[model samples]
Target: MEPIQLTTAVMTIVNASRIIVQFMQNQRLKNQARRRQQHGDEDMNTDFSKATVSSNLEIMVLLGQAHAVERRFWARETSTEWWDHIVLQVWDDSQWLRNFRMRKGTFMELYDLLSPALKHKNTKMRAALTDHKRVAIALWKLGIPDSYRSVGNQFGVGKSTVGVAVMQVANVIIELLLSKVVTLGNVQVILDGFAAMGFPNCGGAIDGTHIPILGPDHQGSQYINRKGYFSVVLQTLVDHKGHFTNINVG
Candidate 1:
């Protein structure tokens, strides 16, 4: 080959190699730019996530503080209980006996007589009166004819408790004390008692009376009396000693 032609060929080969090297360098620059863009996007995303986490924690803290303030406000606004004022503030035995019209011994005795059958549980959640207190309440209802609310206020119990106690004691007394308190099995003794009262040959003396009662639900007019009020007939039989021997009530 001639020297001039060989030199021209070598120059062409060197230019081609330089072109390839320039293209590779451009590709590497593009790759480095893409890598830097990706890393920048990742860092921005991490910073945004950190900001979001900080905001969420601040919101949770605010909610916790709000709830604590609300709870404290409610707790400070609460009131005292009723039972605390009533049972501790005003309770007297003499006033209790005067209101119930029975001695303590007699009340306890009657309670002992009727307590086995009068085991009634209060459906309402309240402080329950003892057996003696229950009997006293029943006697107060019978003797004084006071309102249940008044009796409850005086006795340091709820009105419902007073009403329930009266009803339970009355039911127990009627069921269990009827046979024991009034009986006619002792006919000779009853006749002798009548004879002592100057009424001979009479087994017993029976008397009829009317007791004032509240208007009944079903028949209010039927119980109206000459006094222009409701009443129930109470018939009683007694021996000469004034003790009840036989009794009938309607």
Candidate 2:
């Protein structure tokens, strides 16, 4: 983990040293050449040239050192794709689900089902990312509302990229997954199971839940419920199995 940091520090030092030595050597050679080329205003031109060369060499060396240091850090980070480490065996399945909000197999199955539609196109600039990676990015974003940067850090992507992934994946889920996963057939199964438990004719139970919100501008007071905090109402139909058979947002 720290080996990269140590290597980068060494690279910075080496680059600075090289820049200094090369600058000094170049100035020495230029001075020698200038001496050889000196045929007019010997002392005056020599002093002026020496001063100009010295200042320019110092400036160049500073700029080179800055650039090399920047390059070293950038190079160190670019080589690693941390998202792979999370998806692969570098991290355990438990950790993956804890962060991603779904089992690995479930995520993969979803990715496969949606890949044809969700998979990005390979443009002239770069190849498209895999469907699994895109889904992971979306899951992370959904799992925490204020976690764009955190998700980006874990997935080795930018916050804007994470946001885009979430939007695309969410559109796919709303279009294809929602109806497929929750339908009349699934609702009937839940009702039958609840009936078997002696809760007859009860299709689903209704419950009102208050979900606290920061409230939208211009009409925040309207959203303030009896609980004191500004929140929207969530009327949910939950089955005996503790699954949300249906939900109505207010």
Candidate 3:
């Protein structure tokens, strides 16, 4: 063989080996890039799964809160057995007069007169209270020395309901009956009766008393009377029949 040919053959072999090395390096770089892209896709999928789970948990929590509120909306339950079972069925006429400060007949007559004004119809929430029950509640509150809460317990109603009923009954009575019942009828007849009783020319008797009261927010000291108690003055005049003709309070 010639020396130049041998040298050319060695050069060719070296060129082929360099080409193979370059091809192997390119393949390795492409493999690494593909592995990195796969890892990125996996991470994106994991993040999306976590967000979906979080949203579902938030929806479940809101539903639970809504159910809890619904359960607590109307929790309190009061008994009506006192007025329905005991007072209506068990009590007698004497018991009625003692508790309400009037006979049953008078109470019914008053109910008949006032029912048109005080009547209420039943609604979706509850039954309306009877007119007689309302009248009894008001009379019991006025005649008995008890708190509104106590009166409500006996009447099978709320304390606020008792207070409202008392005010309503009182206002109605004043509007309907005050002028006719509290007036001095026939002035000469009243004077003659007073004269027969040896009180000449006197039509009525007048007196004043201290009514016990809670100390007011303003002028509290002024309400302290000579008896060392808080009170308001109630002055009244009465005819010969001992019926009230005039009244004043402060």
Task: Choose 1 or 3, whichever is better by lDDT.
Answer: 3
Which order, best to worst by lDDT?
A: 3, 2, 1
Span of ten consecutive residues with least summed lDDT in model 3: 66-75
Put down candidate 2 lDDT per residue, 46-110, tens digits, no spaces.
Answer: 66577667767776866665565433223113322676653565766787778777777777788
**Comparing 1 and 2 on lDDT, the stronger one:** 2
Instruction: Please give the lDDT score for candidate 3.
Output: 0.78
lDDT values for all models: 0.67, 0.72, 0.78
User: Relative to the unseen true structure, what is the C-alpha lDDT of residue 52 in candidate 1, on a scale of 0 to 100?
Assistant: 53
Check candidate 3 and list the clashing pairs.
none
| Candidate 3 off by > 4 Å | 1-75, 89-93
Tell me the lDDT of model 3 at 99.
85
Span of ten consecutive residues with least summed lDDT in model 2: 71-80
Which clashing pairs does model 1 show? Answer: none
TM-score of each: 0.57, 0.59, 0.64
Cα deviation of 132 in candidate 3 (Å)?
1.3
In angstroms, give how far residue 240 of model 2 lies from its true place. Answer: 4.5
Which is superior by TM-score, 2 or 3? 3
Q: For candidate 3, write residues 48-122 as lDDT tens digits.
A: 456546645654554454344221124247787888888778888899888888777788888888888897898
